[model samples]
Target: ERFRQVIWPGNSTTVPKGWEIPTNGKKLIVGVPMKKGFFDFVEVKRRSINNAETILSGYSIDVFEAALKKLPYSVIPKYVYLKSPVNYD
Candidate 1:
């Protein structure tokens, strides 16, 4: 049920306004805090993800790394591959 709500958010996959997560729930909650990821395709929604894999993109990554170095590492998105569009969707 949770998987259907996120990850593949097509039409009808939505959350109502002003709702909050349960504080005392026993079930595991995998949280992805990307605000863009919640509403649309995370790729098209976030240009930074595309820029990360392109030429001359290291500078941005460096700044982010420098700021977060003290924090623990988490699963992060890396822009490794890019494909041009053949036809507009």
Candidate 2:
């Protein structure tokens, strides 16, 4: 049977019934942008390889991921690309 689970932000332990709560910890998926810039936080190497594969690594992303790992709950990051400038508005 299929069950619906609703997760409240900042609430780690408590969850509705029928939801497969994380016994050890929660697995969170965070989005990250991979853009190349000399002073930017994350950088990506544009190369022609497997279409399903992407090459990305940087100091800022590494540190951020590390911090997330240190949290009490488990966090899984999902990187997203931001090609253009970010609009705050």
Candidate 3:
């Protein structure tokens, strides 16, 4: 019963705004910091000789991927490498 509501959310007015899924085909972008130290937490590597291919791995990434797998809907994520000295503020 609950699954039906998720698949076909009737009465769009009753549903709260801001939770709508994007219709356009776009993958979610995830920014991962490129750290000089602490590679265990998160590590970004380039496999190709020309540095065209990139790989992301580590404990943090593993946990994130696990969580994504549990979600009811599919969420494609593109991990981008963020240079060090990232400023949140």
Q: lDDT values of the candidates?
A: 0.38, 0.60, 0.79
Q: What is the lDDT of residue 24 in candidate 1?
A: 44
Screening candidate 3 with a backbone cut-off below 3 angstroms (N, C-alpha, C), the clashing residue pairs are: none
Q: How close is candidate 2 to the true structure, as a TM-score?
A: 0.51
Tell me, by TM-score, which candidate is best.
3
Candidate 2, position 34, lDDT: 44
lDDT for 83 in candidate 2 is 66
C-alpha displacement of 34 in model 1, angstroms? Answer: 21
TM-score per candidate, in order? 0.21, 0.51, 0.72
Off by over 4 Å in 2: 1-36, 46-50, 86-89
Task: Using lDDT, give the best candidate's number.
Answer: 3
Order candidates by lDDT, high to low.
3, 2, 1
The positional error of residue 43 in candidate 3, measured at the CA in angstroms, is: 0.4
1 or 3: which has the higher TM-score?
Answer: 3
lDDT of 3 at 17: 54
Candidate 2 displacement at residue 82 in angstroms = 1.4
Off by over 4 Å in 3: 1-12, 16-22, 86-89
